[model samples]
Target chain A: MDTKTLCDGILDGQRRALSKAITLVESARADHRVQAAALLEALKAAQASPREALRIGLSGTPGVGKSTFIESFGMALVREGLKVAVLAVDPSSARSGGSILGDKTRMELLSREAGAFIRPSPSQTELGGVARRTREAVALCEAAGFDVVLIETVGVGQSETVVSEMSDLFVLLLAPAGGDELQGVKRGIMEMADLILVNKADGDLKAAANRTRADYAAALRLLRKRPQDPDGFPKALAISALQEDGLAQAWAEMGTLADWRRAQGHWARTRANQNRHWFMEELRLALLAQLTQAGPVRDAVARLGDSVASGTTTPALAVQSALALLHP
Target chain B: MDTKTLCDGILDGQRRALSKAITLVESARADHRVQAAALLEALKAAQASPREALRIGLSGTPGVGKSTFIESFGMALVREGLKVAVLAVDPSSARSGGSILGDKTRMELLSREAGAFIRPSPSQTELGGVARRTREAVALCEAAGFDVVLIETVGVGQSETVVSEMSDLFVLLLAPAGGDELQGVKRGIMEMADLILVNKADGDLKAAANRTRADYAAALRLLRKRPQDPDGFPKALAISALQEDGLAQAWAEMGTLADWRRAQGHWARTRANQNRHWFMEELRLALLAQLTQAGPVRDAVARLGDSVASGTTTPALAVQSALALLHP
Candidate 1:
């Protein structure tokens, strides 16, 4: 239960300790947060692990067979002598007070595999807080000798984009016959998708799946590609999770893409950028929280906010006035 | 002129004083900034200007006939007994130590018009700083009884988005035979465009202009409409600045859109939001500047930045460590 024991157990690949460590980081209690931070610091400093895990983010709409795809994909990795870890991020989980474990029956095989670890999404209230904890969980998993970490999230709002930032490869799963309308695909999701997979390519859906793959491929070609993408442009493929088909092909493509990125040094650069981004974000959020607590600063924003609302003051000038109070 | 006299002269529509006031705000000198801010405060608090101007943003590629279109548009407005002010925003002007005065010859008629004010883009090093000065210049023009303010910028980088935020309506100008390729359009510019105009539609290019308009209209249909758009999706049209054709139709569309937005309360809401956004941006910039100035904070960042680069530290934890030093 102590930070040292929990960290040691985690480093030793003890499932119980890993679960408990995740809970500690996800906890809202002040004491738990302090202890969790200490454990993370120790784990990070002591981590001399030989090889780092591939952090993959998988996002799909409901009924896209995300759970089934993850199960099959995870099992494939485990079959290759790799230890896999799955961490789900569902911001809407707060509404139902549920995690992705609501249907653990779907991941039966992978859940029971000794080589794979499936942790339910944390039931955290804030998106940023949940994302931070999940990112920390990834570190623990890496230290615990997990060679592959899979992040699963539903394609909704900004959650997918946030998840994509912490990932090395982002895979977007789409169901066959899901209509290729640009309106159907949110702009943010389309822009962030590093690869597109048309799921349910088995039986009657085989032709439809191929058509969907073509449609997505064309869409990706027309869309502006990410500047940091070392693999040129995002490519689309067809897969059937029900039959456990195309899982190996998808995995191979991911490996090739990852390999190219690593060779080009973009992988390291991107990881460093993510760290710096998160660092600045945390600093900004903390500073804002502190600034709001100051009486004079609060008063300034309130008064200036009203003026700005009433069209009496410009935002730039209002900011100037507010900054004066903060630094004075 | 002193701050008070400059403010008074700006209010009185004295061209010399108005130019001087704009120069003051655009100046990087410390004393000039203090004086500029004072003048803005005085102008904002004093001016009970009747009927605010319609802020219109115009952007296009370098050879998209932006200056010709603006000259025609400005002339049309002035002929209608409305005083128009055009403020150009060229962030790259800092590099060449130039504004768009090269086009002054092209805007000869409008430049000599008594009812029009044409100010070239200020040569500012920073985008935010330039944008802030431009916003202030907008307020000064409004106080000086300009009934229509036209903001012109090349559709490059973030300037288009920044200009769009301050404007009541944003118009994106294109040329005939421009191919209308989605890949050619920047995603940010496409998303923010309230109106799409295919300029140079006169004579032989008329057919191509119509085709470009139709293509853009289809593309616009596919884009997710802005949530705050009370007038629905953006519309596309073809215009000819050379023959001064379609100017009236484009002007009428803007008028209708502006009228609808104002009636729906989105006009005021959007302006207030822009103010709040700028206020937060300024606060963040100021906090960052202050943080960098402190020796302890700078030293911590330098150490953590190295760790981040060397892959030894996570960005979130680095931020936490950095915050501790700040708050301590």
Candidate 2:
């Protein structure tokens, strides 16, 4: 099928385009980029038909079996007849400016499941594995009638909090370890996770996991509750992702939090804030692309850069001069 | 003094006015922001002056003796007649939007020193404890003839990298303990630091500290070196903030990094990049504030939020709709 028809099929919720479209959108070939943008715009319009769908963000350190857990959790929801869409985020090449697309391997089960559509998207050198295309991919998913869209960011991307701006519920997965686990995360991360799950709680580690949970719970009490998670209740939980134990219970807990938020009308306000944030991010990125990629200022930027390095011009002077040339 | 005169004094290298100007800039008074902007504009025009100063950013985890070490370090620099200026980045108040300004108390000795100028500026609800106004404070310090400027951020703020963005050198202080320390900090952060100082390394923990230094040195081999610390070297040292052992050496190492970076032309490049980044950040933030704080669209944004929470409208749709209202 042609690009237009592919996009139409995607809009009509045809499962094939849902898979193919992600690949196309993630492609870097010049023609593919053009087609991807067209498809992405169509997907955006389709999702925009009534309103947008809920975008959920999932993140944790790598090797925590994020894929297996996602598969199980997603399958469970699919069995309940909900159209679950998973947009798995992965790291990219800094020099080549492309993605390895390695997540599809880990998410083999979910990728093969019919009711659960999983798209492992590459981050492509963006700050967070969650990229501009990732946001667009999410639009395509919702337009395709998927109810739940999960975005998984790269494990090592610390400064990439941009997902918070895209997601409705931010769920963090943690490997249940000892008290030392707390030291792994920065306080900023601890403050961001709406629900913290201690994954891999199956064997002899179960007791250690529980102790870790208790320690985190105690440590959490010292932190003022995030106003965003204002249920006035602790939101941390322990689950064995491998055993799939507590998976259903965790989903139910997520529902409860969603209900509490809606009843309190905080969800709307939160999304509104998130939208404003995305708009700014888009502008920042677009401007950066334009400024960095422009033909006219590139040489000047490079030259001024050399002068600044040589101390022939100070930073303030260099910037003043560079922007002047770019803007002029 | 009148705001204009106060700003002039700063530009004229009057020490008193620089402090007064920083206080005025940090004030959220109705007129203070406008006054600060004016002062900044005036200072910007006086760009011809090049003061021999090094901007150093110091960060580490909480209990890493960040405050205590800064006190000892700042005092040492001043004793050398360097005319040190420290802008202690305080954590922002998430709710009240007030500043705690605790740096002075934490650095009682340094604050009371004859030639040392220590200013505890509130971060005011930023992800990093470094306040938006901290840059202004730095500029004011430069204008006031301070030869060395130190910016201190709370380790818990998770914005060590943000503070790292503004300075000539990034000094990451780590406490000596915890077998998990290497794994705790991802390669991204370790790669960003120019120098890693193991604090509280005096006496009992010296051996453990040495092990950590060895482990980190081994680990850093896998990553690209920060240009300022060539030989792919991340200077590792042990210091007891309490005893102030190795304090002078730490300062000397920092000075060496600055000199080397300056020689490599990296110092100017770094500052120029920081300036360009500020411009980019300002452009994005200005637009964000304008959109969210707009009068008509604010309520419409609040209204469209409902469809998003009920899962009736996806976040992307709500955003597009909000933008329609905002732009229309």
Q: Which candidate number maximizes DockQ?
A: 1
lDDT of 2 at B47: 62
How big an interface RMSD has model 1? 3.5
Clashing pairs in 2: A52-B313, A52-B314, A53-B314, A309-B265, B92-B124, B92-B125
Interface CA root-mean-square deviation for model 2 = 6.8
TM-score of chain A of 2: 0.81
Shift in Å, residue A145, candidate 1: 3.9
TM-scores of the models, in the order given: 0.68, 0.66
Tens-digit lDDT track for model 1 on A8-122?
Answer: 8988999999999988878755467668778887887777753478999998888888988988889889999999999988877877765655736668999999999988888
Which candidate achieves the best TM-score against the true structure? 1
Residue lDDT tens for model 2, B1-328: 7767886787677768877888876765535755666666666566665564688888776677888888888887888887888875655444433325465777888888767787755546654223456766887788777888888765654566667777777788888875455635545567778888888876888788777766666666665555466674677777878888898888877777777777898877677677656544543343344345647655666565554444454444454455445445
Question: Cα lDDT for residue B37, model 1?
Answer: 68
Q: Identify the candidate with maximal lDDT.
A: 1
Distance from true location, Cα of A260 in model 1, Å: 12
